[model samples]
Target: MAQGVFAITEQRDGELRKVSFEAVSEGRRVADGLGADLTAVVLGSGIEGLAEELKKYGPDKILVADDAALADYTTDAYTNVLAELIQSSDPAVIITGASAQGKDLSGRLAARLDAGLAMDCVEIKLDNGNLTYTRPMFGGKIVAKVEIEGSPQIVAIRPNVMDIVENSKEPAIEKPAVQVGDLKTKIIEMKMETGDKPELTEADIIVSGGRGTGGDYAAVEELANELGAAVGASRSAVDEGWRPHSDQVGQTGKTVSPNLYVACGISGAIQHLAGMSTSKYIVAINKDEEAPIFSKADFGIAGDLFEVLPAIIAEVKKLK
Candidate 1:
């Protein structure tokens, strides 16, 4: 009988991603409800040490698929190992973070297993004792609930959407043998950008700039660094070459659901709102009180961000 909840933890450069912990916490809740054990699977090279970290958030067991071939993420390698684990465990439910890696791996695994998949789910709940997934639709204008009808339901949860609850369990470690087949693609080299601020998709807080910055990112970057939050940009800011495309948050860019989102001088275009509307708390700062951003913001300040940001920075610094 299929009996446990499984969470697939993603790792890059031998470090577990933030979303991995989020998935494990979510799985722990589901597993406790079902009165079953929760298992966490981490894929990487020389990352068996990460299994102990996952245990802090509570999982009955941790499966580490560590090998040289698994050092870099390859579609074929991760897919094969996960498919093998799923077939053997036959878990009641499988959850992963709806990240680039998560989306890629889960979709392929779903096809391989012929399982129902809920992608980019913002909420997962037990309604009437049935698994239900809630996700945004139509460019964040609407949200819909999804329910997978059978066991081993697969769900890819949106990053930073769920709270990480610590339930501390001494998870037993298992070193699984993953047969990595000959791959069409292999990692030759990997490059990483080490930034002072947090990753946008995984940040608990974010500070974003817009065209009003006049291409001056100094203040915006300072504020973000002060808060230890990620720096994001509006489409206009990116288009104007004030920020890189990677820092853009919007419909045409990346979606972010951080706990606290700060918008500086953004007018809140529909495309921009589509990406960050799911943010838990929004604070907008613009000289124009009539700006569209104010409509969705929890707090609004009418002032020049150039002047206002420094004052806010001063106050934030005083606290430090």
Candidate 2:
């Protein structure tokens, strides 16, 4: 039988990612709602310091699995370790970030544990100790609230939807002895993609361009750089080769819940809104006043993006 909720925290480059904190925060809220203990699992190479960092988030327990082979992200290694932990701990709920790495790990963990998984959930709530999850369905046109029917419910949350709150409790650390096994796959080479701004998934502010820019992304890029925002693209722009697929922000692309989302030259499509509509603030710059994006935008600018973007960039630079 399961006892409590556990949040599996993800880390990279020897530090914890923001999504890890978001998972922890979500776990804390769910656990409190159910009157259950909230625990966190930190797995990485040379990560003895992570326990103290996660303790500030009010986790009752911090389970640490540190090993050299676990330094870099490997699907096989992580899946094996997490599956073993879940089998032993028997947590009622397992929450992870719906990030690139998290998505992969959650699905594998679900298969290993034979548990039902709710992916890319925007909200999670516990009703009478039952886990209810809200996830997008049918290309994000509709949202479905589902209840997991088994022990150790698995959930992957979209980044930034949940706020990471700091609690003044010191979490006790427990070092778990993991059995190292032969790997079926080995990570031979690794490449790091460098960008001046933060990743779209993790950025606080995002400025995105679409097909309306007529394949000229200079204005959009300049404005994003001026505002210290990450550059994002609608699926149309990405498919048209105006931007890389990695920069695409839409239901079929990356789902971003940034603090501020600025859409330029992009007509608001339902799929695009599905990814970014949850942002705290949304600003749309387009020539068409009747654009559907303006309906969901907090602020609207009816003008050519080429003209509006430069002015906004100049003003932002002056303010800075």
Candidate 3:
């Protein structure tokens, strides 16, 4: 029988990702509910120092898989090591962040392990000594509750959805020795984003612009800067050549679940909503009162974003 919960953590350049903490924290909660120990498994080269950080998230044990080949993220390399570890450890549940890497890794890992996987889960509940996962389906039109029938249930949770509670446990650290076999892919180069601005998927607050911005993002950037929020764009804005594809928030772009999502100059098409509909609080600013975005916003401002953004920015500055 599977004995414990395993959180497969992701790291880059020997630093722990935000999702790693969330995965471990949520794993801790599930482990406590299931009356099992929680182990966090970190994979990267020279990441042993991360064990102390992982311990603060309440894992009973931390397993570090450090190898030169594991320094960069390659799908086959991570899947091979994790699949072997899971087979030997026999964890009852496996949790990973539903970020880009997490989603990719979990799907391949589940296939290799032949386990049922719940992807992009927003809520995980303990149901009668088992786990039930809630995730959006059909382009965020409907939410579905999913449960796995077999052991070592794999779940990839969306970033920023789970709270990062510090549980602080004196976890026993272990260095897992595993061979990273031949890989089909290799990282030739990496283009790192240059800025302190948080990534869209992990941002706590996001301020986004759309077609209404008229190819000018000064107002949107101003408000986002004042609120310490990441800047996002709709597909129209990106298609219009006003913003890069990385800044787009829509079904075709990145999925974000920030604590606060401010949609400025946006008409809120269904495609755009599919990416950020899971935000905790939504504020929509649009000239048309009947814009679709207003229906989902917690607060609606039926006015031109160009005229409205300065006022909001000023208020945020005053509050700060």
Candidate 4:
């Protein structure tokens, strides 16, 4: 009988991503509910060390694919090997974080295996033998619950959406030598942003600026540093060349589901809301009280961000 719940780990430069643990934690819940074994799969050359770390979160098995070609993630190579693993193991569920890499791999796997798919799931619940996913829809205006039919249901959960739990279970190790050959799409070069602050999507706290900053990120970046929060930008800020496209938080940019999201001088367009409306706590600082941001904020400050940011940063530094 099919009895596996697989969590596909995401790694960059041979290190496991935070969302991989969250997937394992969620997988543990589903495994317990369905009485199936939980397995963690990590793919990269010399990534056995990363796979070994999965034991803390309680998986029944740890499968590591160590190959030099797997060092950098390429769509065709990942899709090919992972598809082969699923076909041979015949898992009941496959969970991956809906990251840049995850979105690509999960969809390809679903198509390759003829499995059902759910994307950007905020919550995963097992009810009446069905796995249901809750996600935002229609530009964050609607909450949608979805379920997939058939075996090997593929779920791509949003980053930071699920919490990881420690169970101290040591999962058995397996090093599968899946034949990974030359691929059509190869990673020639990769440029990644590096900093002490957490990544925008993975951060628990975020401070975002908009057109109101007048292309000055000094105050905004200072506030973010004080709070140890990631920095984000509205589309206007990116368009004005104040922030890079990577920092943009909206429909045209990256989606973030942080614990605390601070919007400064942002008018909160629907496109912007689509990316960050699901944040656990929202604080909006804008001079315009009638700005759309106020409607979604848990706390609203009807004042200039220039004046407000320094005050908040000082208080946060004191508190920290």
Q: Who wins the TM-score comparison? A: 3
lDDT of 2 at 256: 80
Q: Specify the highest-lDDT model's number.
A: 3
Q: Which clashing pairs does model 1 show?
A: none
- Sum up the clashes in candidate 1: 0
**Predicted candidate 1 versus true structure: per-residue lDDT over 77-145, tens digit per residue:** 999888899899999899999999999988998998898999999998885557889988766877898
lDDT of each: 0.90, 0.88, 0.91, 0.89
Error of 2 at 242 (Å): 1.5
TM-score of each: 0.95, 0.95, 0.97, 0.96
lDDT of 4 by residue, 52-99 (tens): 689998999999988887888888888888988888899999999999
Which stretches of candidate 4 lie above 4 Å from their native place?
A: none
Sort by TM-score, best first. 3, 4, 2, 1
Candidate 4 minimal-lDDT segment of 10 residues: 186-195
lDDT of 1: 0.90
The TM-score between candidate 1 and the true structure equals 0.95
Give per-candidate clash totals.
0, 0, 0, 0
